[model samples]
Structures are given as structure tokens and as C-alpha cells.
Target: MSRLLALALASTLGPALSFAALSFAAPLHAQGAAAAALPKPEYLTVEQLRAKYRDPASRFMTIKGVEVHYKDEGPRGAPVLLMVHGSVSTLRTWDATTARLKTRYRIIRFDIPGYGLSGRISDEVAANVQPLDITEGLVDALGVKKLTFVGVSSGGTMGMYLAAHRPELVERLILSNTPSDPVKYDHLVMPQSFIDATARTKANNGFQDMDFWNNYLSYFAGDPKRISAKTRAEYYDFNRRVPEKYPIALVARIGDGKQATIEMAKVKAPTLLLWGNADPLLPEAAANAITRYLGSATISRVLMNDVGHYPPLEVGDRIAQLIAAYVEAGTPKL
Candidate 1:
């Protein structure tokens, strides 16, 4: 199959693959092979997950009838920081960063419906719903007027839409390893090798295949060694528990890149482009494109060495420091 076609297929499969679960019962060295060899894992009910993982900060509310899972942390009166995690990840991705910033800022994060502890969404429900609708509900529900908005990967795409349509609600914007236009930059955004691997996994082990996942996730880090076995297992468990239908439903609603540049041009808030220089999915070229696509008058760019796609998880302290400094510095003059 052609590269673009593979990417298109990959995009649709991306969320589903990440949401599927695995059973990692053996040691890392043994589990990688064992997971692939084992049959797909059984789905863990939301109740089970909540009982096992929910904390004091964990809260649930109805957003468009969906029981959205979210966490509100830090001082209530402090500056607000709304974080959005990318596909295949949940609010927990910000756990490390939130820990560092909670003392100073009000950090709000949620699972994007299908992932994490968020309620499952069917394809029918997702077709009529846009990510912005859910996001707006969260903001309005929390009575947040204006705040700093942060997102990674696909989550960053949601941030762009919100900043464009709800300018007053976003005091500042920060994006990391986000794609400005996925289709337009398909060559850079989804490499051929990655596409091939994705296809092979689908054909062989199916979406629940953790063998591919073990190696696939490693590619997100500059140093594969940075992602320990324990972390991979955590991701596997999270993916396995999500209802099978949610990821497919979520991907069906993802917009093509056809209108990304137009939407991005509408964002006028002060912006920070935090990119990982080593990210294979979104490389330096992708970063440059976002700068060109954004219409923000006050923009700052930071490229960290040795970091990869998931900055919050890989280098949370640094992300926290950057966010604190930038938000405290106030809006930059044009």
C-alpha cells in the first residue's frame, strides 16, 4: 500500500490501538514476547479502574451526558493551567508535571472521553460531538474564565480549536510535539517504517498486540532506555481497560488537516512552542511548520535535547518550570 494510505489507516487505528489492553504478567524481558503470544486481554470495567487508581483529586461530572473523568489540583485561587493529554494517554500523563506545579497553579486535566477513566463513547455519540464541545463544558463547569492552555499531539489540536473559537478563555497557549496539519505533513508526521509496523501488528497480533506496543512506545522517547519496563506495563494496563468501542469512536471524529492552517491562524494568544528535537513522529520540520502556520504575534519556541513526543511524562519537572516561568512572565510584547 502507498505511504499516505498507510498513514490514513494508521491515523484511524492510532487511538484504538492505544486503548486496547494487554496482560503483562511476566518480567519485562519475558513479557514483551508473552504479551504478543497471549490472546487479547479482557476489558476491565470503569468501576474496577476507579477503585484501583482513583485518588482524592479525581472527580467525575456529566459533560454532554458523558461521565468525564478529571482532576482539579493546586491552589483554587492560583493561576489556572488546563492540560490536555494526547491520544493513547490519559490525565495521568500529567501526574509528574502536576506534582511539580500544583503548589503554585491550579492544574486541571481530563481523559478525552475514550481513554483513561472517562466514560466510553460509541461511534454514534462521537459523530455528533466535537472535542471542543466537551472541552468547553469542562471550562464552563469549572467556572474558568481565562487560563493557560496546554496540549500534546492530538490534544494540542483540540487546544488550537479552543483558542481559535474561544479566544477570551485562553490567556496563553502551549503546544508540544503537536501537528499543525497531519495530512499536509503526513510524510513527516508518520514515517513509512512506523506505518509498516502498525500494519504488521494489525495483521498479526491485532490492536491488543503488546509486542508491537513495547517497541512502538519506545520510539516516542529519544532514549528508548528512558521508558522503563514498569512504565510500559502501566500504559498497557490503561489501554486494556478502555472499552473497545471508544477509540474507534474517538478517531472517527478527528478532523483532517485540511482546515488546520486556517484554524491556527485564528489563534492570537501568546504562544509557546515546546518541541522535542528527537521526536520521530513530529520532527524539527513539523515544528517549523507550526511556527509558520500560527498567527500569534507573541510566540516563543523551545527545543529540548534528548526529549521525545511525550514531554510531560518524560520530563515533567522541566515542563513545569517552563510553564511556570512563561505564565508568570505574563504575555510577551509583540
Candidate 2:
């Protein structure tokens, strides 16, 4: 990220902003009030999102009464690969890496209910349903008996939950820049910038906040040049579509002052954690905190120098090679 930005934020919003969950109990009153005043995001419908974000191979299926936008490709007989996108992104984020792997493996990736092509959960039972529940239920609805999971950011956060709670479905895992409780352990804090971005959203009645944009680009790669114009536009569109409550609710799921129940020992599938040294969110040191819990499962840690939060995006070719090698040997590389 920007050292100047970090320094400015620390100086202006000093004494550490209190971390808040998505609940009223967590002191999220101000943000909630702001969200209440704000209208629901526009320009993203299931059909429109699919048209813009989905590939030709993409399809939509109803799972637990929710119309889930998904893509299933590659040889039917090949090994299955399930990909989960992050909070603000759609399955399209995996297009680059998925294209590379499709030649060798069956690829399946989908948009979460509140994101990308899925839009929002239109199901009658949408109330109180967790992302984990929707995701697992979707897998069952699709009859995906077994697969390896490739998750990033918030997706990795949910992936760990699924692996711990329902190990039978996941055969292996590639978790990149995953955090258990983001509110609790914010790798870096840029409070002023976040506030400024929100204010810019108010001023523009849209999501054209470059302060946050720069921060976001920084989150992806240390060198902002890697983030192309098209990538920037797509991210803006997807993120602008985000409802304020969605992120709050995501972080609030475990309740105020509580951490997600991630049983590392329960994650028996061989695990691969790809971290970027320049990751602005959870620095490499912070990312390693999750390793102690892998227990008996073979664990591989690939530390990419000079990369940022999203390894699969920053270094997809190298990441794909690592994943291919990992799948073949199916063993830890220490």
C-alpha cells in the first residue's frame, strides 16, 4: 500500500479505530445509520450481471430456491476444481487462472448470493441464511460429490468454515490471504481513507472513490501497474453493487466479540496457503497465524516475494503451476 496514506490515516484517526462487527452490539451504529440513509445499490440484476460477468459456459441453477449464477467447464472425467470468489468480486475473477487449468481439470466456480451474477438471494428462506449454508447447499443441489477448493480473501474465510464444518465435500484447499475475523485482526488500518471513500460515494451518488481505489489496487499488487484499466472497471462495478449491510453482516456472523470457529485439525485435506509478502491486508506474518491449526494435514506455504493480497491474481501463472504441482504430488512442500 501507500506509506503516505498509512501514515496519514494513523495520524488522523489515531489511537486505533475500534474494530466493529456487523452487529449493533459491536458499536456499528454510525455505519449502520449511514447505510440506512443510503439506497440499495443499483445497475446489477441477475440477468444483467450474468450478461456482463458470465462466460459462454456459464449457467444459472436454483439451489434451495435461490437462483445461483455458476459456471461448470472442462472435461467431465477430469478432477473437479471448485472456486469461490471474494466478497466484492464475482466468479469472473477466476477467468484467467481457470482458463489455464481447464485444459487439465474440470472447473466449477460461482458468484455468492450478494455478489456478482447471483445479485441477491431471492429465495423465500433468505432470512438468516449464512453464506456457508448457501454455498454448501448449492454444492449439494449441484451433486458435486468431491472437489478441491480454491478460495481468496473472504472466500477463503468461508472456505475454512466449510472445510471445518463439512470436510466430506472438500478434498484439498488453496487458501490465499484468508482471514478468520477481519474486524478483529485488520492487518492494516486506514480509517481516514475509508471514511473519505464513503464520503466520496455520498458526494458522487456512486462508487468513484479513488482513495479507496488506490488502496484496493494496492491490496491486489505492490506494483499498481499490474491492475489494468479493465480490471479496475470490473472491480468498481462489482464493489459499487455491494449493499452496505452485506459487509457488515458478513463480519458480524460470528457475533460481537467472537471469532469464527475454525478447527484447523478438522481441515484434514492437504492445505496450501499462498501469501504475498506485500499483502496489505494481512501481512505475511499475520497470515502465518493460521498454520498452527492444520494439525495432521500436510501443509504447504508458498511465500511470493513482492506480491500483494491476491496471489492468484497477482501471480496467476506461478500460482497455477504451484497448484498443478500440488495436485500431482498431493504432498506438502516445505
lDDT of 1 by residue, 1-334 (tens): 4454344445433563322232212123333543454555455777777787788888998877678999988898999999998857788878888999999899999988877888888666676776687889998989999888998877777787888899989888998988775433234444445454454444433444555556567767877776767667767777667456546454212355567777888998888988988986677887888888886637798898789888887888889889888888845964
Residues 1-334, candidate 2, lDDT per residue (tens digit)?
Answer: 2443343333221111112322111123434544454544455545665567766786787665556778888888888888887635678768788878998998889877656766455434355665677678767877788888888776776677678778888888888877644333233654554545544444344443435555556545756677667777787676655443333332213223134544555677788888777866567665667676566567788887778776766677777788788888855543
Q: Write down the RMSD of all candidates, one decimal each.
A: 5.7, 6.4
> What pairs collide in candidate 2?
none
lDDT at position 219, candidate 1 = 63
Q: State the local distance difference test value for candidate 1.
A: 0.72
How far does residue 263 in candidate 2 sit from its true spot (Å)?
A: 3.4
- lDDT over C-alpha atoms for residue 269 of model 2: 79
**Residue pairs with clashing backbones, model 1:** 21-240
Instruction: Give lDDT for model 2.
Output: 0.63
Cα lDDT listed for each candidate = 0.72, 0.63
Model 2 misses residue 207 by how many Å?
A: 3.8
The all-Cα superposition gives candidate 2 an RMSD in Å to the true structure of: 6.4
